[model samples]
Target: MFKMADNYSSSKENKEEIDKNLKGNEKKKFEINKYLPYILIILVLVVVIVLFANLSSELNGISNKLNSLSSAKPTTSVTPNSTTENSTILSDPSYNITGSLIVPPKSLPNDPVITANASFGSRLTNINQPLNKSELALFNNANDSYFEEAGQMILNGTFGGYVFGSTVGSNAEVKILDNPFVVNGKPSVIYFGSTTCIFCGENRWAMALALGKFGNFSELYKGYSSFGDHDIPTIYWAPAHYNQSAEDLGNFYSSKYINFISIEDDLPITGGFQLNPMSTIGARINATNNSVYINAFKFILQLNNFQGTPYTIWGKYNVLGADDADFGFKSEPSGNPSIEYKTHNMVFDNISHPNSEFGYLEYAGADLYIAMTCASINNTAPICSLPVIPKLESYEGYN
Candidate 1:
């Protein structure tokens, strides 16, 4: 009986120790479960940070690519959808033929009529008008894709969308004849201006940019009007030959469909108020021959009593000054002042005047109107068939 009781006491003590060890294991398991949520949260945070870092790198790469595209000059070549293959009309034509006769207005019911004057305007001053090689390179390079697109926009008369300033004198009408001036069986243009004229200097920017569309220019010299004037940079046509071929053909001869009679008459006065006389070939053309320039000037004077300088005669239409339909950043009575030229030049005071404030794109539409109006007179040139011409023709200002 004593041996049985000792065995029972040992068994009871062993069972109690076993129950205590089981409770300690349960407490340890509960503590581990309490810390598990924190560990899981930290792991999720690390994964999100890694993903954001990858996305940020991709975005930085995309931003760099965009910046390069915006700053670099465009190198893509553009070709018109139209073709010149097997064309009856040559892409390049020599506009050399018999000159038109300019007749003086009849006085007192048909007085003795004079055909032409032989006196040429005298060159006012001996100002050097040559542009350096570096300057020319800068100008050519600047005429990149954006400049070309501006030209195209003007031709299409779609520049109104980009208008910026007051739209005054966009295209003021004087008078147009059903039959305009013709040369070599094509329409012609006559521009009479003076180098000393401030308005002419400002007008030349848009005029040069507009004319560049129809043909190329060669030996174009750069100069400013009289320093007393606004002193803006102008493409002095005294030496420029427009509508010429890229191969540097002879001056005063156009390879395009139309002809230009550009006359620059007077130079800025050096120390005096009186402008010096500048000799011009156009004056010679007017003196001894039947010239449209002489007739146009005389007719304009008769119509408006010496309206102003920088007069343009496109066929029968008489455009007195620079015209822009669109508004600019600054409103101008004559033109939109926000438009600028691509070519750069320096003023007399050593200040660099690179761009024009006039609306070039808007003025380009005016020039296109002149070209298309002339085309309507003699629709022989292939350029007349361009789709943009019709859209420009529909505008009200052209009539």
Candidate 2:
């Protein structure tokens, strides 16, 4: 009976120990359930904060991009080979404003019977006189040899020594057009200018020199630009009674390789620098005209807007303004009609001799114009074989 009581006491102690362990596990489970909702809320807040931060960064990036685009400068968009009908008009305000004028009133008669005169305080004695035998001989003597020498000098890279504040070849204002202006079964060179244009007065020297390389002017005349427009002593390929009539439009230039067409306003400078009305030829030529030369000129003007005087077309290239800026002339107290006349006389005398600075610049400018012509004519001329011609062709994007 003593042994049985000892065994019952040991069993009771074991059951009590088991009950205490179960109560401890139940308390732990209740504590975990009480804080479960708070833990889930913290996790959701962290996810939302992370997502909002990422969205705010993306929005800032987009806003910065938009601001940059809005502040950028606009660029001209042009297609290199676009057809004339579909080509974008590239209008530069600087070019358009250079000696350009609005179309004047049409009330002026087409063939006004106005007398030509040099009444604008010009000092030239022979303002609109035909070249005498001596002057003509001098020009003829200098033509061929000077052109050859200029081309060779350009080829030797020595031409730049005389040029100031400008470069030749690629720096020229010439633009390659989409199609060649052909007339009389040959490529055509056209000039549209005004007698009163100051730039035209300076540019005629280069034009005459370049054209002389290809052909001869039969009836060249000595002329002065408008008295009000600085009375620049110049030569006219046609009989342009400078400061007088506006009817003369034909060029007396003859070339076996190309056709030379000149359309100049024969009128002198009017009051307030107002431009004269268009000449009969300029106003009338259209699609109905049977003359291919006239029609081609009209078409090119339509293709490229007529910007200003001294506008020229050498085969396929268009020069919108004076190719070279005025370099060798003084414009202060020393600049006057008499001085300009003397300077022109000096250039004429030194064309073959080239002993003066003005003579050198004239030839250098002519060399650039010759290079442009060579590019237009596929470098077929004998002068185009010079080393500089090919370089110029590449610079002009011809090759």
Candidate 3:
């Protein structure tokens, strides 16, 4: 009986201890609940601080860029002495200045009279329509397959509807007219592209920037009456690669394309051709040497090696701003393709020698346009006011 009583007393003591432990745990849980809001707030504050630091760095880079741009030299620079000296030189025998060199409106026509109404604007319409239901399903499945193989890429992005291996500029060569042409003692640019090329349109912008160095090439998209419907896009760049959006690219090029004389995809200047301009620019294979496999021909094919809205052209020119990486990068991209041209100097005579089908009268007209672009830009006064696509001056025969 005494032993039983001692056991009972021990059990009571154990119960008391268990009750005390349960109360202590309850108190701890309550205390934790009380401070959870504050702890969560502190975590949020830390995230904000990190984001702010990143934002501040981005702002600093922008500030530096703006400062530099504000300090950039105007496209045209002429000191009083430099102008005076140039005038004196022109009067001398060595520098036979063309009449277009004279400044002011007297030397050339006011603008190009756009006669060809085949505009890029028509392309703007129905450009972004999504595919049919079956097509969309197929596209998604294909894109998922690509990701499963390795990783996701732009080839399987939203814009392209997840079509694997397909790209924005899916073309190879831009054939010129089967005829001879000339520019700065070289061939004209028109001899190199068709109306369908995005690169031809893009190259014109570069040609404009470079020519802006010399003369006042008229702003055409809005200024001219002819390129009324031209709204074709360059390679559709992603938001990462450009400050502007895809809509902005469509709108900007629609409103901003300086309509000189550009061929319409439907209108072949000479031989039959099928190609995208941006692709052609990236590839750097003009029409004259479409069939030739000479070293020079192979050289240009290799030089235009990088892809996706290439920032440079003409061997050493930069189309994008100077801040682009020298080699190239994949940080921000749209339709990135690799291009490599190996040739040094682009000699037209070598590529489009007489007897070549691409060397013809139409080629001469295209050449004239190229010459006009360079002459107008490099000219001190700028006189290329001809229509974007020059007309048949005369198709009389005598080959």
* lDDT of candidates 1 onward, in order: 0.44, 0.57, 0.26
lDDT of 1 by residue, 272-352 (tens): 112222233334545654534554444333333234566666655556554443223345445323222212232211112
Q: What TM-score does structure 2 among the candidates reach?
A: 0.60
Best by TM-score: 2
Model 3 poorest ten-residue lDDT run: 237-246
Residue-level lDDT for 21 in candidate 2: 79
Error of 3 at 75 (Å): 30
Where in model 1 is the C-alpha error above 4 Å?
1-97, 100-128, 131-171, 239-253, 269-306, 325-343, 346-388, 397-399
Show the lowest summed lDDT stretch of 10 residues, model 2.
93-102
Q: Ranking under lDDT, best-scoring first?
A: 2, 1, 3
| Backbone clash count for every predicted candidate, in the order shown | 21, 0, 43
lDDT of 3 at 315: 14
lDDT of 2: 0.57
lDDT per residue (tens digit) for residues 224-276 in model 2: 56667676667766556444555445566676666776767666544212345
Each prediction's Cα RMSD? 23.7, 19.8, 23.3
Q: Taking the tens digit of each residue's C-alpha lDDT, what string does model 3 give over 108-187?
A: 12222223434233322212222233322221122212212111122123212211111112121111112112212222
